[model samples]
Target: MVNDIAIIAIVGGLTGVTTVLFGFGGGFVVVPFVYQLFLRQPVVANHALHIAVATSAAVMIFNAGWATYNPQRRRNLSANILFPLTLFIGLGAVMGSLLAGQLSEAVIRLLFIFYMLVTIIDCLVSRHFLKGSEARPLSALTTTVGGTAIGTVAALLGVGGSVMTVPLLRKHGFSMKDCISHANPLSLPVALCATITYTINGWGKIPVSGFLGYISLTTLAILIVTGGVGISISQRYLPKIADGWHARLYVLLLIAVLVAMFI
Candidate 1:
């Protein structure tokens, strides 16, 4: 038991570091890690990925809060755009969470793989759009679309939607830094809604012990502690290293990670 907790903490720490460096909370890492760790146990293996995702999101709420507060002390995020879109995202999140209960693990895994592939393709093909002029008027529409897509993906896979949202935002002319900064706060509504929906829908379905619905409280606690430390470290240094080529590298890395999961 102590060994398992230590393993989870180590993985969570690695995930937090990756998230900080990449500006994505470590859902990609956490999901697979949890899946593998619990693969042999009767510990609800089918829902491991979902639990990983939700637990990661719970951790992100903490990381995002820290990130948002640090920056807001200097300048406010563009909340005017974030507010309306959050409503749609919140709605979509609830819908997606409910849907997760009805879907099988096979279906959710396929959807997650498909979404990752699309994200990779978009990153490679639309690399040119990363530096275009910001479409201020279109922010609301774009936010809605982005939020809906993100919500669906988040509930389906337990990822925070950064894999999709970050690239999309960059394609629409936002710099990587601003895109990440904005996404941290933007994610809150979807996370909150999805967490709630998953809880409600998963009630009485998930076996209790270390779980609340599909979320594992024990796993969440470990992730929070390590991820928090990692976020602080990453925030202090990541901005300096994140350049134009980093996105392509991340795309390749994500693809490799996804392929490894199936193998």
Candidate 2:
């Protein structure tokens, strides 16, 4: 347990950086860390993904909430991009959480990997995510369909929805700062809805003393504190990242997380 806490502290710190800089809300990184951690405990290894995903969802609430309140991020937020879309994201998160609870750990992991692969390919093959597009309106379809799909997949995989939202915004011609800003706020609904559903559905399931359903409260607490420190340190560099570098780094980070998942 001491070892777990130590590792979780490191994970927490990294998540904070990811949250403020990438709008990851800690999911992409945390899920893999927690999942690997649980996999080593024979007693809970079978349900490792659930615990990892649930814990990641819970952590996102704090990380995203904190980042959203950041003065710098607040300045870049676009109301037109976040309004109706966030509502649909919340609705879809509920549905995804329920569905994730029904699947086996192996199945869920595979789906997460698949999601990463597809998104990575899209980002790499497309020029839009790197170079901003022409000016475009926030379309209704993107708000409804796109937002729902992002919420569903993000919740199902415990990825905080930024993996999808950031790229979508970028493709629509938003600056990296604006896209990341929107991503942080957009992650709030997915995190809140997914955490609620996962917590409720996982009651009495994970047989660990530190667990709250599928969440490891002990790990969550440690990570939260360390993650806060990370966010504080990283947030200062938010404006330093150029638009092109930020987008490229986002894809690179995705690939890194995807590789970690496979390992």
Candidate 3:
């Protein structure tokens, strides 16, 4: 229990920084760590990935919520624009969670690996393609469709929806801070829906101590505390960063996390 608490503290700190800086739910970072932790335990080894994904989703609720709340408190978010996106994404997250419950651990890991690689490559190459291009606003219908897609994919991969939401917002002419702000809020619903579904799915299946359907409440509590501190620290810097630098930094961080995920 002491060791777990220590590890959770570290994860929470990292997650807090990542959530605020990148508008992530911290799932991309948290899932891997949790998955590896689960893997080391014999009883839950067969369901490690499922547990990891579920737990990550549960933790993301707090991470993304705080990430969004800080900006909203500053009057940075546009509710008119964010509402529809959240509705669609939230709906999709529920469906995605249901789908995820049917997949095997190996399958989930492979899918997540594929997603990380594709996203890393896309982030690296897309900068050249986007040079000099102006962001264009999408229609309401388009936004809904896009949000649904992002939510679906995010839930499956045990991540906050920001990986896709930020790019979508950027494409629609939102500034870096605005993109992060919106992405952070949008992730809340995705994480919430996924968490509920995961909890329901794992009912009567996961029999590990300190687990409630794969979510470690003890870890969640530790992470929330440290994550809050991290968010508070990172929030001060996010708005000051330039858009280009934000993208570059995001790519670097993604690469680092992906490497960590595999290692």
Highest lDDT: which candidate? 2
Model 3: per-residue Cα lDDT over 1-263, one tens digit each: 57867887898889988887788777888888878887887988888888878888888888887776663534888877687888899878877888998888988888888888888787667653233146566688767888788888898778878888876676666666677777878888889988888888888787756777767677677778988888887767545777778767877877787887788
Supply the global lDDT for candidate 2: 0.89
Ranking 2 against 3 by lDDT, winner: 2
* Backbone atom clashes (below 3 Å) for every candidate: 0, 0, 0
* Candidate with best TM-score: 2
* Prediction 1 TM-score vs. true: 0.86
Off by over 4 Å in 3: 71-74, 128-133, 236-239
Tens digit per residue, CA lDDT, model 2, 1-263: 78888899999999999898889888999999899998999989988999999999999999999999988789887778889999999988888988888889889999999999999999998888887777577798998998889889999999999999988888888888888888988999889988888888888877768788888898899889999999998977546788888889999999999999998
User: Each prediction's TM-score against the native?
Assistant: 0.86, 0.97, 0.92
What is the alpha-carbon RMSD of candidate 1 to the true structure?
2.6
Model 1 Cα shift for residue 255 (angstroms): 2.2
Error of 2 at 120 (Å): 0.4
RMSD of each: 2.6, 1.2, 2.1
Off by over 4 Å in 1: 1-3, 72-76, 129-140, 237-239
